[model samples]
Target: MVRYAQTDETRPADCVIVLGAGTWEGEVSPVFAERLRHALDLYRSGLAPKIILTGGLDPRNTVTDAEAARRWVEAEGIPAQDVFMEEKSRYTHENFLYAGEIMAKEGWDDALVVSDPLHMKRAMLCARDFGVTAYSSPTPTSMYRSTGAKAKFLVRETGCMIVYGVWRLFGVRS
Candidate 1:
C-alpha cells in the first residue's frame, strides 16, 4: 500500500471505507481494485472486521460501485454479511455523507478512506464535513499511469478541494 505520513491513529481502525472508482459492466475498474486489495490486507491483518463500499447506480453497468466491490470481497472470501454497500451516492461528497450516517449508526470511528492519492484531500475533507472520523490510505498505484491522465486528475482534485473547502467552511448540510 502507498504509505503516507503516519501517526498512532494509523493503527487498526474500526472500519475500512473503500471509496468507489467507478465500475464497468458490474466489474471493478483497476483503480477500484487496488483500493479493495489494500482493504483486504487490512481486514486480514485484523485491522477491521467490516468493509463498507460506497457508490451509487451506474447507468451503463446497471449496478452500483458498492455492489461491484461487495461482490469482489465476497468472491475473495469475505462473508457477505461483513460488507456494507451504500448504493445511493452519485458523487464524492455523497459517498462520505451516506457512509457517515451508517458509521454513526454503528458507532464507527477511525475509518480508513481508500482512494487514489490525488483524490484523498477532498475525500478526507468530505469525511470531516459529514462528521466521519476518517483518514486517507491512498492506493499504492492507480490505473492512470499516463501523464495526461495523472495531470487531469490532480488538477480536477485541486479544484474539488477548493470548492469543498468553501462548502465545509459554510457548514452546508446535505
Candidate 2:
C-alpha cells in the first residue's frame, strides 16, 4: 500500500476518473479540490480528452460530490461537454462500477484514476474489481499534510481496505 501510494502511474488514457470525496456546503472540500486539480492538470496536459467525476449525493450535502466537482472544473474553464458525472456512487467500488457504465456508453476503455495518495491503493483495487482499466494518478499533495492527519487517514484506509478485501473474497460486491 505504501509503495503504491508513493508512485504515480499516470499515462495517456481514454479519460480521467476523479474519485469523489465529500463536499462541504455545496463546494469541493480541500481534499477533493486537490484531486480535481490533479485531474484537471492531466486533462490539460493531453493525458486524456475527457474527465469523469464520480460521487453521489451525501445526506449531509444538498448536491452530489460529482456535481460539485463538475461545477468547479467548468468554472476553471473546462468545457461542459468534456466533463461527465457518475452521480450515483457513494463509495470507491461503486465509483468505478457506475463510471464504467459511462465509459461503456462513451466508448472509453481505460482511465487515469485520481485521488489522494493514501486512498489510491484501495481505489485501484476497486477499479480493477469493477473491470475498468485504470492507472493511478494520486494528487501531488494531500490535504492530510500533518503527521497526525496522515496517520489518521492511513489507519482509516487500512481498515477500509481490509473490509473491501474480505467483501471481495465473499463476492459481496456493491
Question: Which candidate should be chosen as best, given TM-score against the real structure?
Answer: 2
Q: What lDDT does each candidate get?
A: 0.81, 0.94
Q: State residue 156's C-alpha deviation in candidate 1, in Å.
A: 1.9
Q: Which stretches of candidate 2 lie over 4 Å from their true place?
A: none
Q: Which residue pairs show collisions in model 1?
A: none
lDDT of 2 by residue, 1-174 (tens): 877897788899999999999999999999999999999999999999999999999999999999999899999999999999999989899999899999999999999999999999999999999999999999999899999999999999999999999999999778
TM-score of each: 0.88, 0.98
Q: Mind giving the per-residue lDDT tens digits that candidate 1 earns over 1-174?
A: 112322123457888899998998999998999989988988888988888999999787888999899889989999886789888988789998899888888888769888887777677768877778887777667777899998887777777777777877887666
State residue 94's C-alpha deviation in candidate 1, in Å: 1.0
Query: Which ten-residue region of model 2 has the weakest summed lDDT?
Result: 1-10
